[model samples]
Target: MISAQNIIKTYGNKTKKTQILNNISLTIADRSFTVILGASGSGKSTLLNILSGLERPDSGSIRYADTDITFLSDSQLTEFRKEKIGFVFQQYYLLPNMTAEQNIRMGADLAGNPDYRETIRAVGLENERKKYPDELSGGEQQRVSIARALAKKPDFLFLDEPTGALDEKTGRQILAYIADIHQRCGVTMILVTHNQNIAEMADTVIRMNSGRIETEQKNQTKKTAYEIAW
Candidate 1:
C-alpha cells in the first residue's frame, strides 16, 4: 500500500509562494487502478508527482508500504524510483534514432529484465518493433512508451495523461491495452487525467479542486475502457 499523510507542496519563494497541494492524505491499495481527476491548475499533476516521488512535498510523509520515501536523499530517491516506479507521460520521449524494440530495451536493461519482448507483445507492438518513432503513429508511439515502462517490471506505474495527445479512438485503444496489462501483471496503476469518463474505469477515483481533494470514491463496479463514454 502507498500511504500519503498531510501532503503540502508549494512553489516559488516565500514572497510568491503558490501552494500546489494542501494537507492531502490518501492511501492507494496494492495492485489497484487509481485515477486522479481534475481540471487545469487543480493540482492533480503536482499531487501525482509527489506521490510517485518525482517531487518532494514541503511538509508530508509518503510511504510505500513500510518505507518512508520522504526521508530519502536525492540520490537515494533516484535509486528508489529507478527500482520501483515506471512512468508514462503525454510525451513519448523516445530517442529518435532508436527503434521501438531498442527503446523498450533501454528500460528493461535497467532492471536486467531479459524477457522484455514479452512487454512488446503485451502492448501489441510486436510488428512495430523495428520501426523508429518517426515512422509510428501517435497511438503507436504511446504504446511503445507504455511498453518501455512496463518492461522494467516496476511495482507502480504512474501515468500522466497517457492519452492526452491521441484522438478518441486511439485513446480508447490505448486505455484498453493499459487495462489488459494491469489485469495481467497486477501492477499498481495511478493515472492522472482531467476526463471524468476515464474515472469510470478505475477502482478508485480521486477528484481534486484548487489544492485539495474534493472527493475520493471507490467504484463498486468498474467499467471497461470501451464501456466509458469518450
Candidate 2:
C-alpha cells in the first residue's frame, strides 16, 4: 500500500508561491485501479507525480509499505521509481529511431525480463514489433508505450491521459488493452484524466478541485472499458 499523510506541495519562490496540493492524504491499495479526476490546474497531475516518486512534497510523508519514501534522496528515489514504477503519458515518448520491440525491451532490461515479447503480443503489437514510432498510428504508438511500461512488470503503473490524443474508437481500443493488462498482471494502476466516463472503470475514483480532494469513493461495481460512457 502507498500512504500519504498531510501532503502539501507548492511552486515558485517564497514571495510568489502557488500552492498545488494542500494537505492531501490518501491510501492507494495494492493492485487497485485508481483514477484521479480533475480539471486543469486542479493538482491531480502534481499529486500523481508525487505519488509516483517523480516529485517531492514540500511538507508531508509518503510511505510505500514500510519505507518512508518522502525522506529518500534524489538518487534513491530515482532507483525506487526505476524498479517499482512504470509510466504512460498522453504523448508517446518513444525514441524516433527505435523499433517497437527495442523500445519495449529497454523497459524490460531494467527488470531483467527477457520475455517482453509476450507484452508486445498482449498489446496487439506482434506484427508491428519491427515498426518505428513514425510508422505506427496514434493508438498503436500509445499501445507501444503501454507495452513498454508493462514490460518492466512494475508494482505500480501510472498513466496520465493515455487516450487523450486518440480518436474515440482508437481511445477505446487502447483503454481496453490497459484494462486487460491490469486484469492479467494485477498491477496497481493509477490514471490521471479529465474524462468522467473513464472513472466508471476505476476501482477507486478520486476527484480533485482547487488543490484539494473534493471526494473519493470506492466503486461497488466497476465497469469495463467498453461499458464506459464516452
Candidate 3:
C-alpha cells in the first residue's frame, strides 16, 4: 500500500508563495486502479507527483508499504523511482529516431526485462513495433508510451492525462488498453485527470478542489473503460 500523511506542497518563495497541496492524506491500495479527478489548477497533478515520488512534499511522509520515501535523498529517490515507478503523460515523449520496439526496450533495459516484446503485444502494438513515432498516429504513439512504461515492470504506474490529446474514440481505446493491462499485470495504477467520466473506471476516485481533497469514494461496482460516459 502507498500511504501519504499530511502532505503540504507550495511554490515560490515566502513573499509570493502559492500553495499547491494542503495537508493531503490518502492511502492507495496495492494493485488497485485509482483516479485523481479535478479541474485544472486543482492540485491533482501536483499530488500525483508527490505520491509517485516525482516531487517531494514540503511537510509530509509518503510511504510505499514499509519504506518511507519522503526522507530519501535526491539520488536515492531517483533510483527508487527508476526501480519501482512507471509514468505516462499526455505528451508522448518518445525519441523520434527510435522504433516502437526500441523505445520500449529502453525502459525494459533498466530493469533487465528482456521480455519487452510482451508489453508491445499487450498494448496491441505487435505489427507496429518497427515503426517510428512519426509513422504512428496519436493514439498509437500513446499506446507505445504506455507499453514502454509497462516494460519496466514497475510496482506503480502513474499517468497524467494519458488521453487528453486524443479524440473520444481514441481516448476510450487507450483507456481500454490501460484497464486490460492493470487487470493482467496487477500494477497499482494512479491516473490524474479532470474528466469525471474517466473516474467511473477506477476502484477509487479522489476528487480534489483548490489544493485539497474534496472527496474520496470507493466504487462498489467499478465500470469498464467502455462503460464510462466519456
Candidate 4:
C-alpha cells in the first residue's frame, strides 16, 4: 500500500547542504506488516513522517495506493492525513487534561468516523475509561495513545518506536499487544525500531541506513509466536 522511489531530502542552507536522506526507495503491500530497523540518525523517523504525509520529499515520489502524495496540495494532504493515516510516536502524545477514553473519542470525533468504543475495548482501555493521562501508568497511557490512533480507523498505521519510552517488560507487553492487533485487525502497520527481535515478528522487515533502504526481508508472516497474554 506504500511505494516510495528515489527520494532525496536535504536540510540546512544551500551553502551548507546537509543531506539527511539519500535516494531512498521502498514498496509495501496491502495489509502487510513492515518493521523499519535502523540506528539513531539513520532517517527512520524522517521516512515515516514523509510516508505518513506529514512532510514531502524534494524529489522522487510517494504513492499510497492510487495517489502520489508527494504531489498533493496542502489542503488535500491534510484531508488525506486525517482520513487515511494514524501515527504512534515514541512519546505518547496524549493530552493531559482529557480523560483516556475522551482523548481517543476525540480523534474519531474529529474524523467523523465511527464511534470508537469498540476500538477502546480493542486497546484494553475499557477498564480505565474515565482516567486522565496523569492518572494512568506509562503502559496504560501508551495504550490510550494507541487507542486514540486506531480510533481514527485510518487506512495505514505508522509506528515510530512505539515502545521507546517504556521499560523492557512494559515494552514487550506493548509490542505483544501491537502484534496481536496486527494479526487480528489486519491493520497494515509499519513499525520503526532499532530492535532486531521485534522486527522478527513482522511480515516484512526494512533495514535502512543514511536515509536509504539497506535491505529488506520477507517472512512467512502466518507463523508468529506472539500470543495475546495481555
Candidate 5:
C-alpha cells in the first residue's frame, strides 16, 4: 500500500509561493488500478510525482509500504525508482536511432530480465522489434515505450496521459493494451489524466480540483477499455 498524509507542495520562491497540493491525504491499495482525475493545474501530476518518489512533499509523509521515502537521499530515491517503478508518459522517449528491441532492452537490463522479448510480444510489437522509433507510427512507438517499462517488471506502474498524443481510435487501443497488462501482471497501476472517461476503468477514482482532492470513490463495477466511451 502507498500512504500519503497531510501532503502539501508549493512552487516558486519564498516571496511568491504558489501552493499546488493542499493538505492531501490518501492511500493507494496494492495491486489495484487507480486513476487520479483533474483538470489542468489541479495538482494531479504533482501528486503523482510525490507519491512515486520522484518529488518530495513540502510537508507530510509519503510511505511506500513501511518506508518513508520523503527523507531518502537523491541516490536512494534513484535506486528505489529504478528497482520498483515503471513509467509511461505522453512522450514516447525512445532513442531515435535505437531499434525497438534495443530500447526495450535498456529497461530490461536494469532488472536483469533476460526474457524481455515476452514484453515486446505482450504489447504486440514482436514483429517490429527491428524497427527504429522513426520508422514506427505514434501508436506503435507508444507500444514500444510501454513494452520497455513492463520489461523491467516493476511493482508500480505510473502512467501520465499515456494516450494524450494519439487519436481516439489509437488511444483506445493503447488503453486496452494497458488494461490487459494490468490484469495479467497485477501491478499497482496509477494513472493521471484529465479525461473523466478514463476513470471508469479504474478500481479507485480520485477527483481533484484547485490543488485538493474533491472526492475519492471505489468503483463497484469497473469498466474495461473497450467499454469506456471515447
Candidate 6:
C-alpha cells in the first residue's frame, strides 16, 4: 500500500527552481511488480529516492502504509529506510573485502535481522558464498547484491538497472532471478530501467518524460508466469 499522491519535488531556490517532478502520483499495489521507464535525467532516480525516503518532496505527500513520510526527521527516515526498503543499484554495491555470503549476512545484521541463507542458495550463489566481489563475474556480483537486499526481507525493493552491467544473456538471467525473488518472497517491487524491452514485462509500466508520467499501461492478459520467472 505504497501510494504517492500528486508528489512534487523541486531543486534549487524559488527564483531558479528546477522542477524534478511535477504532480506525479502513483501507487504500488500489494505484491505487485512495477517498472518505471524514463530516459536519463528524466527524474526517474529522484522519484525513486523520494519514495524510498532518501529524498523529500517540496510540495507533495507520500504515504507508506500508515505513516506519512513528508516531514519525518532525518533519523526517523534513516530507520525507516533500514527497516522497510531494500535497494539494488546498477553498480552492484558490494564491499570489496567481504565475501558474497558475508555481505549478504551484513545487510540483515545491520537491520537486526537473521541472515537469509535460503535466498543466497536461491540466487545460485551458495557455492560462491566465500568469494569476494572482485572474484565474481558481473552477473554473479549482481546476484550477490540482490541476495543481500532480499536478505533484509524488506517490505519493498527498489532496483535501479539491476542488469545494466551484464551481457544480454546474463541480463536476461538476472531479470529472471529478480522475478523469482519477487514471486517467492512476495515482496513489492519497483524496477527502474531504460530498456523498454524489460519494461514491457512488468505488470504495469510507468512511462516518464521530462519529470512527468506520460502514460501508464497494464498487461491484464499476459499471464503472470510470462513475467520473467526464473
After superposition, candidate 3 runs with Cα above 4 Å error: none
Residue 38 lDDT (model 3): 99
Query: Model 6: runs farther than 4 Å from truth?
Result: 12-17, 223-230
lDDT of 3 by residue, 1-230 (tens): 99999999999996899999999999999999999999999999999999989999999999998899999999999999989999998998998999999999999998789999888888889999999999999999999999888999999999999999999999999999999988988999999999999999999999999999999999999888789887
User: Candidate 6 residues 125-214, lDDT tens each?
Assistant: 989999999999999999999888888889899999888788877888888778877788899999998887787567888999989999
- CA lDDT of each prediction against the hidden true structure: 0.94, 0.93, 0.94, 0.86, 0.93, 0.86
Error of 4 at 169 (Å): 1.7
Report clash pairs, candidate 6.
none
If scored against the real structure, what TM-score would every candidate get?
Answer: 0.97, 0.97, 0.97, 0.93, 0.96, 0.91
Displacement of residue 129 (Cα, Å) in model 5 is: 1.4
Put down candidate 1 lDDT per residue, 1-230, tens digits, no spaces: 99999999999986899999999999999999999999999999899999889999999999999899999999999999889999998888888999999999999998889998988988889999999999999999999999899999999999999999999999999999889989998999999999999999999999999999999999999888899999
The candidate with the higher lDDT, 1 or 4, is 1
What are the C-alpha RMSDs, in order, of all predicted structures? 1.0, 1.1, 1.1, 2.4, 1.1, 2.5
- The 10 consecutive residues of candidate 6 with the worst lDDT sum are 221-230
List ranges where model 2 is wrong by over 4 Å: none
lDDT of 5 by residue, 105-131 (tens): 999999889988888888888889999
Give the distance in Å from residue 74's predicted Cα in candidate 5 to where it truly belongs. 1.1
Q: lDDT tens string, model 4, 73-105?
A: 999999999998989988888998999989999
**Pairs with steric clashes in candidate 3:** none
Collision count for each candidate, in order: 0, 0, 0, 0, 0, 0
Q: Residue 125, candidate 1: how far off, in angstroms?
A: 1.4
Clashing residue pairs in candidate 5 are: none
Worst 10 residues of 3 by lDDT: 221-230
